[model samples]
Target: MKEIYSNTQRAILWLGDYSDTAVPSHPNAVLSRGEVKAAFGIAEDLAADRHHDTPEDREIAEGYRALDALLKVPWWQRIWTVQEALLPKHAVLRYGDTEMPFARFWKAFDHYFAQSYRECCGEYWLDFTDTSSNVISCLQTAIDYRRLLSHDQGLVFSVLISTFRGRLATDPRDKIFGLSGLAGTLVADYSLQPKDVFMRAIRTTITDSGSLAPLLRTPEPDRAKDLPTWAPDCCAKLGPEAQHSWDMVWFGLFAAFDAAMGTKAAMLNPSAGPVLPLQGLLVDEIYEVVVHGICRDRDEFCAMARRWQHTTETVAKRNHGVYPRGGTYKDAFWRTMVGDMILHEFDAQGTGQSRRAKASDEANCRMLWNPNGDHSMGVPFSRDRQFFTTRAGLIGIGNPGPKVGDAIYVLLGGRVPFILRPTPKKQDGATLLEYVSPAYVHGIMDGEVMKEKREPSWVHLI
Candidate 1:
């Protein structure tokens, strides 16, 4: 596994590492704006949404079907290619007989998105419409999966696990072991069992750097299995709730813990592996579970939004209107639901053009109370999923599976409080409390619950 990860034995040439001779200085090889636009034009003509009128359009459309065919290939969705392409010092992408520098391809791709965005906003033309928007968007989204590779190279293990979870892998274990090189200090020992590999990787990470932020980005724990809720199964795909965990700032979550005390030590018994102990405060119990109704269309979404509004209103009224006159709490709720969206005041306020109104505006038009001058900012809500409110009335976004009995705890070095369900076990005539599932509680993610001066307790995960 280590040798496969190291890429020491593979002699096959990957997509990005092609020689300079392959990518000649020909005009066809150059990724120019005009070339991209022409390619997009061909894509637009081939799309079923719009009708092609001219003979020139039909002729150009036929010429680019090969390009469309190439784009549709699952090559981009392959996991092995991603690691192989990213690890090399110099890389270039090749399509059929043509070759182009990988850096230039990325630049062109970014430019295409920007161009389409500009067109959408009426920057280029007030009536501009992109027919090939879907094609460009898909490729851009794929590129985004690798964005962390360049941004923060240190957290490569977490980054790879987060980004490429959707991609295809032949072996389930390859999902965890393939990108070990990018993990900086977090390397997997091939000797460990495949199941143990993932757990060890996460444990090693927590042991090396006494922070639990990595645990937050993990997949939901299997309810029937004994696997630690804190340990993510890299083999499984990350759901919508766990998707945004990668984007969170680690230091910000651990700021309070770091400020008060130095880094917490990990209690690991190397001989006896599965029992890793952590000390943290038990924050609160989940009394209510609110599953947002599935909204397939406009009317359904609006109705759900109204119901959500009413729920928030009732909750606020019971608390004697803890929010100010502006209904900021209601706005915060919607923002949390949307999670990490950048909205503008005018954009939220409908333009009265029904066709032009965005889906976000259609669902909810409220804005967060921003004292700062900036109009656009990413909200901290986990977004695109259902969340729950704890007994203490703290808002949280975590696994939708945890029920009323599950308890939330803020571990000493953890960035987010985990949702642990207390199971009654009669062991040696004494009832024991065994905690399950280390979940992400939204509001208390930044260790605000820890500042309450509550005593921390040790919970053993069996």
Candidate 2:
């Protein structure tokens, strides 16, 4: 196992080296016909954008035209033409890949980016390189490759390296140490200092934690009114052990974060005063709230669902696309909410409500939380609130309140049902009915609701 893992890691390191060496200092040396075409395609796409009509746009347009002309030339002449076009004498040489000319070597680099790497490198290997099974695992990998190499982490890198090396080599935890070593080497190669690399890693971790912390911190107005009404009665049905396991998994993530902070802090500058230890503070607060405030009450599960909904809504409001919104927010929101909701709902309601109400709630919650409706407007909070209660009730998660579904399940007990119609009788035997879950049903409903709400759209809303 050690040999196999070591060989795999070595291969990845070699690939990194190969990728680095392939990049050329010059923008255009000799590009393949396909490379020229790809560049031209990208340029044309940019030119079509609304902002491309300015004087700057025209200048860019002229460059693209020149490149397009070179692309049209015969293969041999085309190569020479691009080289001449990107020569040092040309004022635009400074632009490199942008407007500058490149020699044949640089052109090859551009071509490499355009190719499908899966075909050349093998998809299985790439998956292994990128798979992240835990928060710490992902963080450590990102720190090595993305943060240390791409950003700053000088102090953090040194601390991580020192700590990792000091660990007992034969210990089970040495895998983590080995991973840290790899990260440190990658960062050093990328010209990032230890402090810069680790700081960025810490920042990235904090940025992710920020989304969940706010939800955890929110308080329920009256415990009596909320807990019994929202708590799933199916706990007795699922058995105590299963429920306890579920709670352990949920809270364990928080505990892991707390445990990781001390190691993370060691990477920081000791002399630096705390302006805002935002990441550390947020992690501590989330754990406190979850363990003390939410976990103690029967309504705590419902509270968690409500918190997720609230946080999703807040993030969505901030990101309603006058400016382009990346898919990260949606991805993060869905993964965190869906995983927690499903597990918690299972704990609360057992297997009985798992298929329908829980599923339906997931759909409706996604719909209500969607910031982008076809109507090009935000959904009203009033309508969203109604959907929350209705959906939660249907799913068997909880009753709707301002705080409901924010932390627990976005839909609580409200899942839409798909009842099957009976099939016509067959000659061979009796007819039967089958039910299927369609993917777009919830999305369509959410779109309709957004259209109904018709709130004003704005840039920089978030």
Candidate 3:
């Protein structure tokens, strides 16, 4: 499968059971191999005819059922198959006795996905309960995979990894090794030991690319103790709670710089390993770890609302009236974390109880607000509380682990400010900072601080 990345030659995709392959059975398999093959034939036919402009309701439901069954095959979940299927010149997916063009399959899947979203969003008149939840999940994974392959041809190494974080691999090392070819020049050595691959991939990508895009990823909870705080454990799962679409939250930063800072040329000696030599200006030091909960019940929602208000007041006081105009700073923060599209039911009062409302009072934020799960407007809090406010009074939400004394800085070419924890070592006799992660400082992320004439300086990240 790794060979597929280097081979630009044409390839064919065989989706049916390969008797010699030792891949494990996926737990979500609900249909026999033969049954899946048969379903593929029906699905292919349905997809071809699904575009009839005025189809009956019963006809559309039948199409959804057939398409759902075909998507459940184990082939979609494997990590290795991702590059193999996607990089091929022209591909056809075959299940048992049926075959169809991969492109046609996706076009059909897109149609069903649109219908599903509308029904789930209640924009369509039909009820959404008829479709199975498993089908919805399968379609989403497939779509995400397609999107990952379709875009991001020029993105740095770590950003590419973030694109496919949820994919499963039997060997953890394969997760990094698998993308060696796709990430190309960003990875200096794909031959490194599996355990060492992630470190090399991360260090090389950061220095070579010069962009702090890697720090934007949400780290896996069980991150290896030896791994630097700046590097993400790409091998582990992001869990269901992680907002996979955080790129949108940091879009404000990109809007200012138009790109992340990082060059393909090396800034330090290649012989020097592990530690990175970065030059950035120190913007703020974290003085407090703000705690806030998900909007579970009315009280939590009100609390979150108050936090928004407090952040606005803090921003206005510190920045001297420079803040989001027309919309409150709370709205801007919400747009930074979530997107701008507010769910009509949540914001529109007197609209009766929304069917999308969740019953649980626990701190499960993803479900309560993020019904679409796309990180659009109204995302639930990933954790019960998140970190915010450095000693400099810079208030913004960040990854869960930053603490007091950690420093926030704006690296040249970095779209957003990064939070770094000081490490106990020096790189070639110079002080170094251990990169914590990128942050969402409400006023600074969008070039507001640069407007105040702050000069750039060196800040090493260990």
Candidate 4:
């Protein structure tokens, strides 16, 4: 597939015959080839509205609908098509009666819709518009990746996997196989079990980089089953609240928050079988854990708020009404709920675009108070994360339903904290730890654990 695309003068991405969803075939949806070229020429916002009462707004909205239909085609979802789209000299996209150069479509969609997906992928999980926007934005990055390839610039295996994890394949092994051109060829044996194939990829990556930073980008658990817990599963999807995703985007690896505080990862030998030896400081043990489904509606959002309020009241009552933080217990609970992460504000009086929350947001104690009834108001993290209470009064969010007693640690050369579950089993006379998931703890994100006088120790992970 790569060879065909790389050798081709121009690649035709025929979306006309391939759609993942039913599309409207109304006369209004008739975006003739000329109209497509004109739409690509449009540099300003289309004044579209859901109310569709005005003819102008309805026309604009219908136009976007046509484009969105094309973007949803399964051709955009295939993993192999990434190489197909990027390796070619020029790619032309066609759907229905519209045909335009990929570049023009990218430019036009970027102006109106791309930011919604690039920025708020998690917040708009159910938004039909953002879905199309995400596809195009990812396509643009794939093109940029081709540029990096041409420049002899290298991206780590983890970054490649983390960045494009959601792309699907008929054969599960193709998930890694499809990325071989960009990620450098791995030990390519289809006969090997998927676990072994995945393990070799991790081993190859670790050997090449000499850093376990790949492990730092923990994939959501219960995927790529039978693979060692420590080895990252490329199969994991990158959700919006994914701590590692935010860390990579908002703060470049080790630039903003180094839980290791400038410590380099141990150059552990990968040839030593599946057990990975790592150096890190054990910070705390999980005492209590909480997991909630992504709030689907205004009521669910309010219910989650009530639950948070209950937690705050519990904390306040336990502390004799004067919680020992910079603010009230309600403030602390809300901050901990969102991992103190940045959140775009939504309310009645203020423009929904007014301001994102400050890092240490004390003012959003009235967080659940969304008079505008915006579902996104208090929902910064959900679906894949679980709230947890550490043994030492630390509150944070983790993945895969953090079990009680799971040990949290700041790995050397890691960008975020990781939780490792204790096993009754031992390996080579050492206590074995099973990888739980990557975490987003509020207080310990910026080297707070490293500040403690505790020394780093070697732990064995499987």
Candidate 5:
């Protein structure tokens, strides 16, 4: 046991070292506006070539067409664009920067929309009636935009799931919806934060006691109706434009969650054998831990907690047989080991270490909260000074109980990866600390972590 713990600790520290060395120079930095535009232009040019003899070319063309359509939509018509337009005005209102009226903002939006439309698609007409195929083109554009902007796999998965759920509610062709739904789900899952968005959506729609009963009672098409009352309300409140935006965002979150979970799980138990079902549960648990970590830094803990509950419920699938399967127990064990090491490392580090670490974490958070500089209103440590101080204190040694556990749960279950999990259970039920020793080792000795596979078993159980 001591050897295993030591090896694991060493591996973790090594990983941190590598991460520190490599993360700063990562080539896939956030895309600049010019880059984004150039990519779009290239895609559009490729799409305009309708005489592609190959099926792949045809598909690519179709995608480009969709992108072109989306680009044509007036900035005001798109929620994201509208939000961007509103930001300056909002900032002005908040910071007293020459009070601008809402009307002025709207006019600015219109002007920007007109200019963007001309630049992107060579059109200037304001009325949709003048354009013969505006609706279809707009939908296609939205779809294409979703495809391009959905760089993150989890966000893609969430969007796909939303698309699937939406079709399940409205569309009649099961196979069409199913295929599209699966694609959307996968994309969203890979691209978005599944627990933060979709799992919560499911939990909010379906309750603990009521989850399985309705599925057993209804056909596949009607199964969604069994969802709890909050589901529809939540969906409705997101609004149509926001819904589209979230579809992409959620997919990114889901993908990240899956990747992080799968990687961590593979590292923890290299010899878990081929219990695929258990593997799925482990992935879910890893996701939960990541979410918990992220949520710990935010004041909206309850929202994150609710998200965790929803995620667990989603992964459990409300099947009694699967619920008792002990994968989550193992996941808990790994989380404890990892969480303790992270906590101890943070605690042991002086102010310099804390500042360095906090800088990276804050940068990641800012990226997550991209386009919203003042987005950390409810977070625990938003400012650089606050983040540095809080992180320094948090890294200090202490009883890894509710705080650690809460953090772990949130990271695995929340929208971000800010929280940390509690320590593992010892023979006497005390939290273990062997992994935190400086000489401790880490890394997976063996085991092929499941990568990028979608399991519908969870839905069946639910």
Candidate 6:
């Protein structure tokens, strides 16, 4: 499949005969053919829109309607379309009287949305619903990859699984199989059950990245039947019990933190399945924990943020009336919300600036927190995480928030701190444990515990 697309010059994609925006203007009317620079939209880029859309929304409604019609076609919903549309040099979307370059159709829609984002998705994200398990949201899987692949970015296996988890495939196993062509990670194996396929992908991701961090991003491993505690459920999705896509929420985990401080996974898989060794330092025990509800609007997000800020202040004061690292409680809480990842794209004047590495300026983070300010900057936050404190007064955020007394550790090969629950059983003279989740605790994220000279402790996790 990779070879075939590589040799092909142009691929004519039949988006079905009913596509409304299939032929925008005409086959010759490739609006901004050379001008459209990948996907310019607020969905991923968060377009720097201080004064959104100089034109009225009614003027841009046609683009949304066109996108609405194109998304209605079945071609955009398939998991296979990821490689189909992405691998080709010139892919055309043709339907009814519509025949437009796929890039133009996709970018024009994205560009329009970016321009009028405040009017469209700024309030409720209702129109596009990027997080929802619907057709329109599913289209984002293709759009994001198109941008990634175009710029020649490395597509890691677990990140692809995280990106395309919401996509549809005729056979369940195709989830891994479909994305394998994008990056030569997993081979096509029908003999493998969906469980084995997913496990293989997890193993491959671990081997490639040399980190067990992907396991932490898995929605909840305890819920899987046959998979090990360290195996990520590459197939988790928005089912009846789920409302938000965990894939999209945790996708950033691939490049976000340094819990183990660049330590490679020094793991030993004694059996066919994975079993985590207990040779990690016991860091802290979770104390006060609060599992937050999802924020549906700007006002709700602000209100909940304030409440979280208030709680963090109380905990910080009790811990010593100051953050152990010397900053004020108010200073640290805001940084923790966004996991301290800054966009490095925006300046004080709200204009776009280019920088290659991570920026430490607090004002840039504050810029992201503004509801009316430019968000082209990366202000990554998830309402699904828990705001919790440790017995030692350390504040942090984690998923599946471990119970009050669940242990936290900088496990071997882990890029971030992991939460483990103790069990009655013991292994190899160490305490038996259950892998709960990965965490983002402030202060200790930079390998401070590993720097301390002490006897190593092993945790036996199933």
Best by TM-score: 6
lDDT tens readout by residue for model 1, 155-202:
445545655655567876676766665554656466776667767776
Candidate 5 lDDT tens digits, 1-462: 222332331111100011123243333233333333433443333233212223345443443343334333332132222222222312221111113233332333333233332343323222223221333223333333334343433333233333323221232222122322222221223343322333343332122111111110101112233333212221232224322332222122222232224232111121222110101212211222222332333244444433433444454443331423233422322221222111111111111011112222433333323333333221222111001001111111111111222321111122222222223534234332211000000111111122223441110111
TM-score (C-alpha, index-matched) for candidate 1: 0.64
Residue-wise lDDT of candidate 6 within 1-462, one digit each (tens)? 777875778988765543134456444333232112222222223323323332346524344334444454556567887777777889876554346676765554444334433244432233443433255334444556544443212234555665566678879899888888776455788998887776676666556556664464545433567666665565554442233343354445435556666666654563345455635778889888876676565555556556667788788768767887656776677667666654443334322223212336556555544676444443334355677888877887777547888988887666678888887877567677877777877777777777785556666676
Candidate 4 lowest-lDDT run of ten: 43-52
The regions of model 2 sitting more than 4 angstroms off are 1-30, 33-38, 41-45, 48-269, 272-462
For residues 211-247, write the lDDT of model 2, one tens digit per residue. 2111111012332221122111111121122222232
What's the distance in Å from true for residue 65, model 4?
3.8
By descending lDDT, how would the candidates be arranged? 6, 4, 3, 1, 2, 5
Candidate 4: segments with Cα more than 4 A from true spot: 1-62, 86-91, 94-99, 114-163, 183-191, 206-213, 216-225, 232-256, 312-332, 343-361, 368-378, 382-384
Please give the lDDT score for candidate 1.
0.48
Taken over the whole model, the C-alpha lDDT of each candidate is 0.48, 0.26, 0.52, 0.58, 0.25, 0.59
Encode model 3's per-residue lDDT on 1-462: one tens digit a residue.
555544646555555542323562434435455455445644564356333234355554454444455554556556676666656666677654356777666555555455443344232223223223333343444444444444333233455466555557877666766655555454435466554666666666655455555556654668767766555677665544223443323322332342123322234553355565566667778876766644455456445645654665676577564453233443444443332223333222111111222223122323333333343224432223364665545566666678888887777656767778877777567677877666666556545555556665556555
TM-scores for all candidates: the values are 0.64, 0.19, 0.69, 0.71, 0.26, 0.75
Which regions of candidate 1 are displaced past 4 Å?
1-68, 71-74, 113-155, 218-226, 237-267, 270-272, 323-335, 338-384, 425-446
In model 6, the runs with Cα more than 4 Å from the true position are: 19-63, 116-155, 216-222, 234-249, 274-280, 343-382, 425-432, 453-461
Task: List residue ranges in candidate 3 displaced over 4 A.
Answer: 1-10, 17-72, 120-156, 186-191, 241-266, 293-302, 314-387, 424-430, 446-455
